[model samples]
Target: MLTCAVPTTLGPVIGAEQGHVRAFKGVPFAMARRFAKATPPLAWTEPRRCTDYGPYAPQPGQLDQPEDSCLSLNIWTPVGADGPLPVLFFIHGGAFVTGGGADYDGTFLAAHGPAVIVTINYRLGPLGFLQLHRHGLSEADNLAISDALAALDWVHANIANFGGDPDQVTLSGQSAGASMVIALATLPQARGKFTRALALSAPGRNIMSADHADHIARRVLAELEIEQDPSAIASVPLPNLFAAVERVGRRIADETEAGTVFGPVLDGSVIPREPRDVFADGTLRDVELWLGSCRDEMVMFLKSTPPAAMIRTSERNLRVAFGDAGWERLLACYRGSVRPDENPYEALLSDAFWHRPMADLARSHAEAGGAVWLSRFDHRPALEPFLSQGPTHGADNACLWAHLPDFIDRPILKRKGGPMMPADIDVAARFQTSLLRFVTSGMPDVAEAWPRFEPHRESLAIFGQPFQVVPLNEGARSRLWAELSA
Candidate 1:
């Protein structure tokens, strides 16, 4: 095995060469105690071997053992870059409760972009996001986001050694990770760290209010039977803490129709306001952005939900999310747009939770003078588990990283040993090419083909067999949402 060594600020790291890329895995970027802010890793004089991945944050059903010292990151850089290459710093998404940097292998993308790719692990679930400031544990606020920032700081300082341009970093993520991308773009701490952003399926409205976060924390404490002594939370067994998280998460989801209980909180300090508000107020006008979502984002969740419960829960959640009259209007609009096979509730909830908010964010950013590009992933692999679901959640990921085995093995698009169809390969190529162009040049395509998203026109690029640009809010459902917001 060919080995390559790069000297970082802390020490020398020995990575391996695979194909046309050099991969440095399991590199410690930061360290932190349970619920504490992350700190830079201790410096070392000798070279550290980073051939394998690091541990993920503690969560139920994870194959690898979880650890508190999970603030490591992985790096992949092209073998023969002409000069410094742009960096793609990605955060993984599992609703803020699961996923780690190890899950994504950036080797293919690194070689493809001829750019440096960095992915980091952060605290998850109750350990990372269980806000306890009101309960006297002030350090527990936004630890996960803090971990991400520390990783970014490490990359900004050391990635130059790996042939990455610090000033050309593109902050990117999907799902819960996408939410963090939006958070970082608007955060004061993240300013000047990255020049561009790419968010996929970002839950724009997933942020929790301080009161709701405190309530969840209180519920977790009560479940742990340590309501009087909240600091005891730091010492709770991993299994016990995760159990409490599971219980409280389910209860909260049932009560509030919330997708996940743990995420960034409006702590007035760490994350002062909602990301959308920041975009509306033009704080991120200088940052270039490429935002996108799958056409059927919620089918991933809908497949698991019983049809009856899906309807009942969706109705209750819609009523709670939008007022009685608004709920009626939303349903009416969605019914007209939904296909015969699609569930109206699924369409309504998907728009209410994911797509519409993404459009609004694009509009807000564009209106504020930020250069923006919006897209929708409409290509689905012609195979079982996928053909039935259309372009569902993670579908875009599967296509974007079709060269990666992890994405192929994703349960969302399990190919069952079948080879990819010609269309699948074509779409993957097109999708990756567009993203690579954006990462390198800050624009996905030619101006005429992929115009900058405008608040007045709302152009959206559709990624499918035949890629096309269309009006973002042309449909009745989108119009209704615009009307309702107005």
Candidate 2:
């Protein structure tokens, strides 16, 4: 590892180890503007401070309402950048609503291994996604993707100065953030920018359609009372425009009963194609991949939704997502005998969506001769109310980052051994240990040989304490997928 400087572009940026962790705040990767719509990025001059993570674009009405704007990046180079280290860049997820680089602190992540950890912020909701208003740059990138690309470019061009390997960069995201990882891989622009990717609890494409994105965009516009259409609304003041967006968001949460369906548009140029299509081809062949999902993913989201509602909704979504075939296959997989009263919905949610697709992704990649790794988040929820939503989304939030939740000491995940301590040490440790190995050597630390997934062997590494291979349920999930894809 070569220790290099953090570039002159960010003049005298902060964050030198200082005993615990070296944190730099307000690092600007791209100059931001609240342009009309579809606005393109303009570069900034003057030495910008790379010393900290910057302010969150704006998010008040989303889940967990984001406690603060520590919207900053805390670099944990345990040993300082004296030696070049593999970098792990994290993208926090809040269902594309609320969350910023502020959610995570790199200190704990740095202790797990010899890696440089960087967390970043991107525009969310109306600011980041809303498809209808592009303020007018025809060929500029999708706003959210552009933000990610800008950050990647920043890391590539400048990480060397921070004693980090720009070439060995691994981008990891959760939920919608995970979708970003997958999207980034398929993006023509992200080619070779990152060496590896880790996507957890995410879906690759819109299960919905253009009409859906359009409908939502239009609805928000209308609610903003911005009398004009999407194009016309462009002239509205940024604050007014955003106010309308928030109104629609509140309506989505409080008014309408519509299920959330935010995702990247199948925009022909920037996205090119859905990540599934891209992966099917050879777009991400050169990149090492790791995919994971919790044992009860639906439960994670369910923690917010009522338990009964969780089961009811999962059942309904299964029908909607997989349709008739999915419903039938699910019946067969768990058998019609599942405890009617027990609400086996969470387990099925995990298996059908996250677990199943992730496995399928591994098989498809390996069949195409790509290197891929797989795992499951088996940690259970400690609280009874949370137990039903076993290891919910962002469950790994605590373990991946440290000193992050000051007063929110314990995460939802429960340990089998006792209270406060997670019942699943194995799951977190395996994830931590293997990630360190993967970042350093470009290969994961695993039991036996880390074999590429194949149709027959279906070699996927389960990420409990002692990582090992787990068989994939192709037959059942295959039938369900056929329905889902249909």
Candidate 3:
């Protein structure tokens, strides 16, 4: 029973270090009301017991209890750390609609310490990113983004007593969480909150203007049959609100150019401008960045989508993205040739939606004289059939944090061949080492294999069995996409 009372500005917190790592779960970082900016947690006298995970914000298919004041965080620290450790503060990904800090178990990542890992939960879905200011609800919009900023503020103020160095915080996330890291990095308020960031498979195109946010909010109100009395939405039952959010999200996703719904809105406040503009203007000049996408970023989505539907969906998406003639030109570029089993539609979709955008962000950061390291995660798990494919979107996450709770569909370290493969151990070790290295230090120490991302010399680290740093010009699909875009 390793128990200690750590003093914070808020109060004393009691946490325990167990077998694998010491964890302090359900630590309230902030208190927030619906549609309002988050505030710091009220001071407490007694040492708050942080044994169980906190409630996740209300969203669809969440097994845990729903709560509005869901601005809590979970901290995992090394069992025996003498000095203040570097901090890895992670935000989760679920397209900004679903997922919580507790969704990721930081035990594995924390075990590689002398470093502390913190995961956070914020509001999701319409309750999160929808800007309701136009509906006469005058409150801070971008609630989810605000929640993230508040979480960082809390960490900066209180992480030192938890054996974490407030000055060496590394903000990290996957997908929407990655997007949040980018958004937060842009804000001046976040300037000194963290020293560095690592974004995994960031959804670069999800941000929308305030008008688009209002459009989604109106759609959700209509779906709930309360567009005429929008204020009633605040009092609607949680399940009803969830259903309305889903219906509106699906509708907007089908009809909108951005192709997604409910994300950080450019309200000229929280997110003053698009992330691209911020990056271009050197907003994140001080923060060291390690950002990358998986090799088959869109494969996970395509796995469930039928083959025929994949083709049709790709065409539809292209038509929506580019006009008729442009779509045809782009499609023709992809039709050149591919592997026997490779679907050109899937390849093009990956490029247009994820890969190109990720690379573009890297380019923009590099162009603005920011210190950035780019990577492509190509590590495939040792599956039974052994498909000659790259790692799917967010697959590196499972490998990176292998000590997470057992997910039914995603069994950790177990390929169909059964048992943890030696390759799995090697890959996990490399990933863990690289991640810890980057967190503790500013640059990734990938056995001296990776190079800093420079505009003229664009080399990307490839995380596979035989890890190597390859020039970005070596990838054929990326070349084709660049030519087509030009």
Compare the candidates by TM-score and give the number of the best one: 1
Query: What would the per-residue lDDT of candidate 3 be over residues 399-464, giving only the tens digit for each residue?
Result: 676643221123111232234467666776787788898998888874357888889988788888
- Model 1 over residues 1-486: C-alpha lDDT tens digits? 547568998899999998999899989988888777788778998889999887767777752454656889999999888759999999888778877777677887889888899988888887788898777785648888898988999999999999999999999999999999898888888889899999999874657788888888899999999998888988888888888888786677666554447788888888988878998888889888999998877787778654323334556766775679988998877787778777787778777667778888898899999999999998887655567888878788767766732234443112332466788888878888888888999998989889989877889899996999998767787677767767
Report lDDT (CA) for all predictions. 0.82, 0.61, 0.76
Name the lDDT value of residue 443 in candidate 3: 82
Worst lDDT run of 10 residues, candidate 2, spans 407-416
The best candidate in terms of lDDT: 1
Model 1 weakest lDDT span, ten residues long: 405-414
**What is the overall TM-score of model 3 with all chains considered together?**
0.91
For residue 35, give model 3's deviation from the true position in Å. Answer: 1.8
C-alpha lDDT of residue 228 in model 2 = 56
TM-score of each: 0.93, 0.80, 0.91
TM-score pick, better of 2 and 3: 3
Q: What is the lDDT of candidate 2?
A: 0.61
lDDT digits (tens) for residues 268-373 of candidate 2: 6567677776777766778888887765567545556334233454466667765777577676666543544333555566565567678777777777777887
Ranking by lDDT: 1, 3, 2
